[model samples]
Each structure stands twice: as structure tokens, then as C-alpha cells.
Target: MEVSIIIVSYNCKSFVFECIDSIKKLTELITYEVIVVDNNSSDGIEDDVVIRYPDILFFKNDYNGGFGYANNIGLAHAKGKYVFFLNPDTLLLNNVCQTLYDYLELNNNVAALGCRVYDENLNNQMSYGKFPSVIQYLLEVFPVKWVSDNYKNKISSEGYLTEDLDLDVEFISGADLFVRKSVLDHIGGFDENFFLFFEEVDLCMRIKNAGYQIRITSQAKLIHLMGQTMQVSFQKFKWFEESRYVFLRKYYSKKFIVFSKSIFIFRYLFLWLKYLDKEWHKRAVFIYKLK
Candidate 1:
């Protein structure tokens, strides 16, 4: 197979069905297989999906593992040279698989690539970015317009939200990431330590450290119904915060982690006091006791 398209789904049956339909309808000119790993969602996605697409390889876990854990299961069974880790909430707008495959075939230096991602209304979404740092986190907390503008410019320059041309980037979004299986094997796949967010960042960091380039291109496109699978809630915020800490701890020095945690605690406390929202207070307490 040229590509093994793996989708890890949880509690988003409709989105998964639509995503698979889009893949089947739009993707052509590439030899590919579809794999769906269900993280024990309560929805009857297994039966429905199996009935609808008997050819798709489907696995259902007994419990909900994190994104990386579930995808690792799919990776273990993949038989392709490249693995496309696609989110269940995405719809292909073009022959995205063929486009990414062609790009990687030509650019041997790039081990991973993501295509242009858009919202349902066709507005571009952030599809790639620089590796996270304490400095970047601090800048996000600042309220000055010029400071924010400068930060945005830095992201643009570093290839965060490019719209027109293909660019080598520090990391690609997990939403539509296309990666060589060899690089994935070298890095041992996504870090299962990341329960939610930042897994792709960690994977990309490892790939870059292994001397391979990461990139994003505009030659292909997809529509992502952002946050459809993982809705914004306190639990989602908790998972994000936990994964952020995990990522920083893995890649940063002790002093850097200490400074990052201190800044996060201070920022959350400030939000708690300024806004007086119980949610902020809860977050502050949660981070304070995260250990």
C-alpha cells in the first residue's frame, strides 16, 4: 500500500462516517487502506461502520485510550510506506492523499507533511507551527497589540499559517498529518504519554531531531470541523494542560520546566483573580496541584 489512512475515533460516529465517505469518494490515484481504531466510545460506531464499510479494518478497544495510544494500535497493523493520521472530523476537499504522497516521493528530506486545512466555511485553520517554548507561552499571555502582532509575524515567518506556498516547518498538525512509516518506526510512533494534545508536537520534535524535515503544503486541502470530536470543556482543558506539562517535561531542562510551570501557575492565578471565574480558579488549583 502507498498509504495507510488511520483514524482514531471517540464518541463521534457521524463525523467518522462522513470522514470515511469523503475519503472513499475523493481519494484516487493512490493505493491506500483505511484503518479505524475506536477508543471504546459508547456510540454504536463499530456496528454502523462495519456494516457500512466492510473493507475498512476496524478495531475496538475495551477502554478509552488517548489519541496516541489508539493510533499506535493502527500503526502496528499498517502495511504502507506512509501513514496518514487523519482526524475523524475532517473531510477531504481534494485528492489529499495523492498530493501528500507525491510531495514526499519527490522530497526525500521531508519525513512528515500536512496539507492546507480549512474550517467548514473555508477559512484557513492553523495546520503547522514552531515547537512550543516558554517564551512563546509568555508572549501569549501579554495583552499588548504590537506584542501580539510581532508574535503573529514570528509564527508566519516560522511557517505556522501559510496559505499560498509549500514550506518546511517545525511541526505539522495531527489533524491531517502525513508521515513516512520509517520515521515513525525510528521514533517509536506517537508518545503514548501524551493523553490528548501535543503528541504530534512531540513526534515532530523527535523526527526533526532525527534529521528529517517536517512540512506543510497548499497543493491539497481538507475541511476540519474543529473541536467536533473533542468539545471545549473543563475536562478538555484539563487534558490539554496535562499534555502540555508532559511535553515540556520531556523536551525541556529542569530549569525550563520549573520556569514554565511557574509562569503557568501565575497566569492561571491572574486569570482567576481578574475574571473571578470559578473555572479559572479551578484551573489554577488544578495546575498548582498537578505535580
Candidate 2:
């Protein structure tokens, strides 16, 4: 096979149908396989996708394994030269596969490629970003978002301010990361440590560490409904806080982890004081439990 399109799905039923329908057209250009790794979603989605596209490889998990684990499951079944890690909520554009595949064909050094990312309204998103640092995170969440966003986040801002509809990007959204199978074997797929957020950054960084180039193909396009489909059964703040700590310990140095924790402390403090809201206090206490 030339390509294996892997989509890790949770409970989003309609989103899966639309995504597969779009990708279905691309089979003519390149020999491809679509593997839908169902993460044991509460919704009866396995029967839904399989009934429509019976030819698709459906690997249904009995448990709600994290994103990385579910993706690894699909990767194991992949029989393609290139593997596409696509979000379930996005729609592929015409020639999206061919565009990314042809680009990787010429540039053997490219470890991964991503399409130009746009939201549901077709607005350009900040598809590329510097790996999250304390300073960057500060600028993003601070009271002075207007100034920090425009001035400090230049590349991030520039990525959104593209003159051309589609252009090369530094870091593409993991929602649609297209990677070569060889590079995947070398890096051993996404750091299964990351359950959700920053998994792509960690993956791209590892590939760069192994001396490979990652690309954001200008021609490929996809409509991303950003965070609409991602969800957890528990309290949003609680679950995110749990995974945040997990991510920090796995990716950051001990000192960085300490620094990050302090920042989180101060952040919640600032929010609590500023809001003077009881909800803020509860969230602060929740984060403390994380430590």
C-alpha cells in the first residue's frame, strides 16, 4: 500500500462519516487503506462506520485507551509506505493525499507533513507554532492577550496571516500529521506517554532529533473543527489537569517540571484573585491535587 490513513475516533459519529467520505475519493490517486481505531466510545460508532465502509479496517478497543495507544494500534495494522494520522473531525480536500504523498516522495528526509489547517468557517488557524515554553504559554493565557498575541507570537501570528491560502508551515497540527513509515519505525511512533495534547510536538521534536525534516505542505488542505470533537467523561478541568502533569513529567526536565508547576500555581492564583470567584478556588484546589 502507498498510504494508510489512520483516524483515532472517540464518540464523534457524524464527523467520522464526513472524514471517511472525503478520503474515499483519494483512493483513486494513491493505493491507500483507512484504519479506524475506535477508542471504545460510548456512542455506537463502530457499527456506524463499519456498516457504511465495510472494507475499512476497524480495530475496536474494549477500553478507552488514550490517543497515543489507540494510534499505535492502527499503526500496527498499517501496511503503507506513508501513514496519515488524521483527526476524526476534519474533512480532507481534493488531492490532499496526493499533495502530501508526492512532496514526501521527493524529499526523503521529511519525517512528517501536514496540510494547511483551517477551521469549519474556512478561517486559517495557527497551524504552526514554536514548541510550548513557559514564555509562550504565559503570553497565550495572560491578561494582555492582545499585545502578546500580535507582537511576541510573530511566527504563530504570521502563520495565520498567510497571503496565500496555503503555505509551508513550521509545525502542522497533529490532527493531520502525515508521516513516512520508515521514520515512524525509527522514532517508534508518537510518544505513547502523551495521552492527548503536545503529542505532535513531541513526535516532531523526536524526528528532528533523529535528523529528519518535518514539512507543512502548501497544497494539501483540510477543514479542522478544532476542539469540537475531543471530550472526556470526567470534569474537563480535572482530566486536563491530570494529563498536564503526566505530560510535564514525561517531556520536561525535573527543573522544568518544577518551574512549570510553579507557573501553574501562580496562574491559578492570578485567576482566583482576579475573578474572586468560588469556581476559581475549586479549580486551584483541583490543580493542587495534581501536584
Candidate 1's C-alpha runs over 4 A off are: 148-150, 156-162
Which model scores highest in TM-score?
A: 1
What residue pairs clash in candidate 2, if any at all? none
**lDDT tens string, model 1, 50-69?**
89999999999999889999
Model 2 lDDT per residue over 47-77, tens place: 6777899899998899976888899999999
Output the worst ten-in-a-row residue range by lDDT, candidate 2: 155-164
TM-score of candidate 2 on Cα atoms, chains taken together:
0.88
What value of lDDT does candidate 2 attain over all alpha carbons?
0.77
**Runs off by more than 4 Å, candidate 2:** 143-151, 155-161, 165-170, 231-234
Q: Give candidate 1's error at residue 145 in angstroms.
A: 2.0
Candidate 1: the clashing residue pairs are none
